[model samples]
Target: MIITLPTILSIIRLFAGFLILLGFLLLARPAADILAFVVFVSAAITDFIDGYIARKFNLVSELGKILDSIADKILVIMAWIIIITYYEFNSWIILPIGLIIFRELFISGLREYLASKSLSLQVTFIAKLKTTLQMVTISLTFFSGIIVDGSGSLTTFLLQPVAGSGTTLMEMACIVLIWLSAIQTIYSGWEYFKTALGLMGTKNDG
Candidate 1:
C-alpha cells in the first residue's frame, strides 16, 4: 500500500503506544507523567482523525484497516496491562482490564483466522464504541492516578499538586468507565464471533 496521511497517523499511534507505556511506568515523576499524558492524548486524537481522513479521502485500504485495528489494540491494551501492573495485580483492577484485554486478543485472533481465509471481520459499531470508551477510560485513569486534587477544582492531568477525595472520585469514575467499556468489549467480541461462525458455516445459536 502506498504511504498516506492516515496510514502515517496510524503508524504514529502504534509507536506512541509504546512510548506512553514507558512514560506511564515511570509516572511517579512529573516529567514522565507529562510525557505520558502528551503522547497518550495525542495518540487518542489521532485515532479519530486518521479514520476520518481515510474515509473522507478514499484512502481506506486493507492495510489501513489492519493497521488501525492493531494500533488501537496496542494503545489501550498496553495501557491497561501497565495499569494493573502498577496496581500490583489488584483483583479489582485486574478483573475488568483483564476481561477487556482477553476479548481484544480473542477477537484479534479471529480476525487473523478470517484473514487467512481471504476474509475480513468488518469492525462493528459496538467494537468502535468499545475502543473509544476504553481510550477515554484509560486516559482518565492515567490522569487521576497521577494528577488531580481534593478541592475539586477539577484541574486535569498529572503531577503538579493534587490532594484527596476529589482524586479518589476521579479514580472511581475511571473504574466505572473501565467496567462499562469491558461490558461493551464482551458484547462486541460476541458479535464478531457470530459473524465469524457464519462465515465458517456454523450457526451461532447462542
Candidate 2:
C-alpha cells in the first residue's frame, strides 16, 4: 500500500465507475447523461494516463494492477448495461454485448485459477484492440444519444434509427464496432483459456 500516483489514479477510476452509474440512473435529466459521459470519458483517459505513468516512472505495483482491472470491468460492464437499458436494439447489438460480458467473466475466472497455480496468462494485442474498440463504441453511442436525441429521453436509439445522416452513420459505426469487439472477445478469451490450460497441463486440442 505505497499509494503511488498511478495507484491514486486507479482508485479514482474505480470510483468514477460508480459515479457513472449514478449519472446514468438519473438520465431523466439531460445533464445527468452529460455527467455520465464526462465521467466515462475522463475515466477512460485516466486509464491510459495511469498505465503510461506507471511504466514510465516505474510505479507499477500488484495493488495497482488489481485495482486497474477491477475498475475497467466496472466501467465497461456498467456502461454496457446502461446502454442496453436505454436503447432499443436487435441481436446485432445485444448478442455482442452478451458475448463481451461472458468473455469478461470467463477470462477473469481463468486468470484467477491460473494465478492460484503461480501461472500467468498474457494478454494479446488483439484483446487490447477489442477492449479499446468497445470503449470507443460506448463513448460514441452516448455522444450520439446526446446529439441525436438531445433531450436525454431514455427510449428510442435503434427503435427510431431514422435520425439525420450524421447520427445514423454514427449509430451504424457503433453497431459494427460492437460486433467486432465480440468477435475479438471470443477469440482472445479462447486464446487465454488455451494458454491457461497448457499451463495447467490440460490444454485443449480441439
Question: Which structure among the candidates has the greatest lDDT?
Answer: 2
List the lowest-lDDT window of 10 residues for candidate 2: 151-160
1-206: candidate 1 lDDT, tens digit per residue: 48889989999998987997677566555566567667788899999999899999899887778788899889887788877865578787899888989998998898888888777777778877887888787777766655643333454433333365333455566667878988998999999998898887743332
- Candidate 1 has what TM-score? 0.84
**lDDT (C-alpha) at residue 107 in model 2:** 88
Off by over 4 Å in 1: 25-27, 148-152, 155-167, 202-206
Query: Model 2, stretches more than 4 Å misplaced?
Result: 27-29, 89-91, 149-167, 202-206
- As a whole number from 0 to 100, the lDDT of residue 8 in candidate 2 is 91
The RMSD of every model to the true structure, in order and in angstroms, is 4.4, 4.8
Model 2 pairs in collision:
none
lDDT of 2 by residue, 1-206 (tens): 47999889889988987887787676665566678778888899999899999999999899999999998888899888777754465565678889899999888888888888777788688788877887788887777666655534443544345456433555676677777778888888888887777778853332
- Residue 142 error, candidate 2, Å: 1.0
Model 1 lDDT vs. the true structure?
0.78
TM-score of candidate 2 relative to the true fold: 0.84
